[model samples]
Target chain A: MAKKEWEKRIAFLGPEGTFTELATKELFPNDWTIPFKSIPECIEAVDAGQVDLAVVPVENALEGSVPLTIDYLFHEADLFISAEVLTPIEQNLMVHKNNVEKYEEIESVYSHPHALAQCHKYLYYHFKSVPLSQSSSTAAAAQFVAENPELCVAAIANVAAAEQYDLQIVQKNIHDFHFNHTRFFVLSKRNDRIERDEDKQQIKTTLMIKLPSDRSGALHQVLSVFAWRQINLSKIESRPLKTGLGDYFFIVELLEDENAPLMRGAMEELRTLGCSVKSLGSYYTYHQK
Target chain B: MAKKEWEKRIAFLGPEGTFTELATKELFPNDWTIPFKSIPECIEAVDAGQVDLAVVPVENALEGSVPLTIDYLFHEADLFISAEVLTPIEQNLMVHKNNVEKYEEIESVYSHPHALAQCHKYLYYHFKSVPLSQSSSTAAAAQFVAENPELCVAAIANVAAAEQYDLQIVQKNIHDFHFNHTRFFVLSKRNDRIERDEDKQQIKTTLMIKLPSDRSGALHQVLSVFAWRQINLSKIESRPLKTGLGDYFFIVELLEDENAPLMRGAMEELRTLGCSVKSLGSYYTYHQK
Candidate 1:
C-alpha cells in the first residue's frame, strides 16, 4: 500500500543531525528532509504547505514531554500527527577536528538546554569551571563548533552531527543513561488514516482534553470511563490551563486501532461531563531498531 | 519569634535582577542576597548550610511548575519550604540606553527561553527575522545587553531588572497574559513549625506521590482520599521517572497547613495502597504587595 517514489519534502528540528532528523531518516530515508530552527516554524511550514510533513520531537523517554511540541500541537498548530517515530538517543561531545586535548582545554560547552540537562552529571563533574551556553539545537552547536575551530569550545550532539560537521568526538555517550530515546511526531496537513496490518503496526490515538472547570472528581470520572471500558492508556500528561493555580488540562494517548469503538464511547462520556476533546490523530507508531 | 538584628543571607537564581531575586529582595530587603546560576546550586547551598534560605521559583500561573525547581526539591534536595511568594509578573523588553534605531538593527534577541515564549506575539510581529537566544536568566540577558552595549541585542525582563542593569525599557508589559504570576518557594534547611495566626497566613502542604505499579486506579484512589477529606489541591505536577517511557511520579500541593489530621489519615491510606509519600513541608504562603 506504499509507493516507492515521490517528491515529498519533510521538515525537522535542525540545522542537521538532530534526533528529529534521525527519526525522519528512519521513516522516510529517500525523502528530502529540511531543518528548521524552531518547532513552531517547522510545524507552521507544514500548515503553510511548504513541506509534506514536519518531524518534531514530542517526548523523551527520560525528560517526559517536550513543552514546545506539546504546546504547539495543543493550542497553536492546526496540523495533525500522521505518524510517530521513536529513536534511541546517544549524545556525544564533539569538538573541532584540529583541536587537541579537547576535554582538558574546554572552557565552555554549547548545546540545546535539554541536551545539557541530559548530560548534567557529566558536565557538572567534567566542566566544573565551564559555562554551558545554549544553542538552538544540538546539531546547531556542533555546526558552530565546526566553524569556530576553538579548542576551548565544544558541543554535545550526536554521531551523525559529528559526521555532518566533520567534527571529532572527544567523548562518547555523554548522556546520563543508556536508555535515552525521543519520540518524534510526523505532522502533516492531511491526516488521512493509512491501512495497517493489525499485528505489524499498532495504532495509537492521542487526544488532548480540557477537563471541565468548577467540578470536583471530574478528572477521576474522566479516567473511570477509559478504565471501565478497558481502554489501555499509554500516557497521561497534565498541563496548566494558565487561568489559575489549580487549573489543568490533560493529554492522553490511548492504545488502539483506528476508529476505536470504546475510545469513541469514552469521548462521548467525556463530552457528557462537558469536557472539550481534540483528537490529535490515529496513526501506527513507527518503532525503529 | 525571630530575632531582629542579625545578618541573614539569601541565595536566589542569579546573576541578579531575576524575578527570584525580586522575590528575595521583597522578602528580605535588609538582608544580603546572592545570585547562583542554577536553582539546584541555590538550593544545594541552602542544604549545605552556606545560606539561610534559598528563594526559587516553583510555579508560574501561566507555564505551570518549574520542573528544575520541583524535581530538585522532590528527588534531590532535603530542604523544606518555609514560605511561598506570589509575584504578578510584568515582562519588559529592555536595551542599552545609548542604542538608537533598535528594531531595524536587530540581529539576535536575548532572554530566558520562557520569557521569549511569553512574548511570542510581540517578538514574532516585531523581530520576525531576528533569532531568539537563550540566557541563564532573564536578568542575565538584561545584564548582557547592558554590558555589551550592542544595538542589536535586547532582553525580556522586569522593571526591577531593567533598573538594576541600567537598561532602558524598550517596551512595557510585553507579556502575553497580564494574570501571569510566579510562585516562589523560600527554602530552608530547617523545617521548623512557626506559630501562625491562621487568619492572616494560610498553611500549604506539598507532597510527592509515587503510585504503586500493582494498582490500576491508585492515582484516582489517592485523589478520592483528598476529595473526601475536603483537602483542596493547589497544584499537581507529574515528572518523568527517567526509567522508561510512560513512567512518572507526581508532586502535589494541598491547600492546607502543616500536619492537618485529615491529611495524616490520607497519607496512611495512601501507604495502605502501597504508594510512597513524602511531605516536602508545610508553610505559610507569603504574598507581596
Candidate 2:
C-alpha cells in the first residue's frame, strides 16, 4: 500500500470494530488508522511519533472515567489533547449468523467487563442463567463468537463490530439507560490545530492538580480559587496518586479556554498555595449527532 | 442448620472465599453468614429481613469507589451503615496443586476484572502471552481452576481462596502497589451500636448531597459550608444520578460526627440553598492490624 499525502496516520485503541474505531473514523474520515491493543499502546504510539493523532476514550457518562487514560496522560505522557469526540454508546446483543435462530439457547455471553456491566438489566432479563465471560474488548468478543460458530455464544458490542465480524444483531440499544455517552480524547505530541466544522463546537480546558500534602481542606481551597473567580468546572474527579491510600490528584475540567486569564490566574494562585497544577489541554469537542 | 441463639445471620457478597467474606468475619467473628451472588443481592437480603446485616465493599484504594454499593445504598435501600472495616488487600496468583510444576505453561489467568487489573504489571511481565478471563469473583476463578485441573490455568485471588480451593500459590502479593486497602460497610435496618474494641477507632460521617440545578459553582458552595467552619472532609466523590450526562450527586465523607454542630449547620445551610442533603451514616471505622 502507498501512503496518501493528504491522509494523516492515526492510532486508536482497537482490534478493529470497537467504539474507538467509530470515533477515529468520525474524526479522520479519510485517514489511515492503526489499531493498537490497548489504550496505553495507542497513547504511546502518538507519544513515540508513530502516528499524527491518537483517539482514545477518556470517560463514559454511565460508567464514569477511564482511569487508565487519565492516569497515563497525567503521569507518563507529555502529549496534548487536541480534540474530543462525544458519541452515544449503543450496545447491541450480537451472535454468529448460524446461531441467530438459536438466540434463546445462548449458553454464554461475552464482552468487555464494562460493556457487560452496562447491559446488566437486559442480560439479566433475557439470559439470566447464561455465563457472562469477559474478553479484552467488545470487538475481541465479537471476533471470538465469529470464529467459533459451533459454540452457542453471544456478544454485546457496537453495530460496527457486527458488520466487521459477520455477526447478526439480535438486539439493538440493549444498554440499560438512555443518554449514555462516552467522551474520547484526540491526543497528539504537539497541540496542533484540528480542522473541523466550527458550528456546534464547544471549547473545554482540562487541568490536573495535586494538592499540598500538609494542608487540611486543601481541595476546598483549590475549588475556592475557581469559585471566587466565577469559573465553572464541568467535571472534577480525584484519581489515586498510587503513592499511598488517601493520596490523590484531581482531574478538573473547566468550561473555558486555556488562554482565559481567569483560568491562568487560578492556576497561579493554586501554585502559590503549593498545589501542582498541569494543563492537560484546551480542546474543542465534536458531538456525534 | 438451625439458627444459633447468639449468631446473627449476616449476608455478604460472596461464593465463600472473597474479600467481603473476610470483612464479614472480621466484623462478626462468630456469626453465621449467607453468601449472595452480587452486591445488590446482599443489600436486598438485609433489606428484606432475610439477614440481620450485610457487609459489602464500598471502596478500594486502588480502584476508588465501588459504584454499585454506593448507588444501591443511595437509590434503593433504606439501610443505615452501622460500622466500617478497613482491610489490607493482598492479591496472589494461584494454581491447582497438580500444576505446581507446570506454572510456566499456564494458558490463561482468571479472576475478577478488578483483581486482574490490579496485577496488570505482574501479569504483563510473567504471563505476557496468556489470555486473561473474568469470573464472577476471585473465589469463583479459583474454584474454576480447581475444578478444571486438566487445563493449565492460574487464578489471581487471596491466600484464603488458595486454601479453600486446595491450590498452590505461585506468586504472593502480586498487586502493583502497597497500602492497598478496601473499605467495607456493615449495613443494617437500624443504626445499631456495634460492639468492638474502641481503641484506635475513628468516627466519620458520610453525606450524599445533590446540588441546586440552577446554580453554578454549587459544589464549591456546598464545600464552603464546611470550609469556613473548619470541618475537614476525608473524601469527596461524584457518582452519576443516572439521569443524564454531567448530572452527578456528590458523596462527601466528613471527619466529624453527625451530631457535630458544624456538620449539622452545614447541612442546614445546604438545604437553605435548595440542595437535597441526605445523611448516609455516621459510623466508626475498625482497622485490621
DockQ score of each predicted structure, in the order shown = 0.53, 0.60
Model 2 agreement with the true structure over B55-117: per-residue lDDT tens digits: 999988877778889889888988888888888889999999999999999999999999998
Which digits, one per residue and each the tens of the lDDT, describe model 2 over residues A174-208? Answer: 99887898889999998764757663466788899
Local error of candidate 1 at A117, Å?
4.3
Candidate 2, number of clashes: 0
Docking class of 2: medium
DockQ of 2: 0.60
TM-score of 2: 0.90
Tell me how candidate 2 scores on lDDT. 0.88
Off by over 4 Å in 2: A92-136, A144-156, A166-176, A193-197, B92-136, B148-156, B167-176, B193-195
Model 1, TM vs. native: 0.87
Residue B268 in candidate 1, Cα distance off native in Å:
0.9
Q: Across residues B1-289, which tens digit of lDDT does each residue of candidate 1 receive?
A: 3545686888998888989888888778888888998889999999899989999998887777787887788778888888788888889878888774554466788998889988999888888888999987898898888889845688899988899989888789988887888989989888864343542576888888888883666666778878877887766667888787667888877877657789888899998988899887888766666
Residue A244, candidate 2: Cα error in Å is: 1.9
For candidate 1, what is the total of clashing residue pairs? Answer: 0
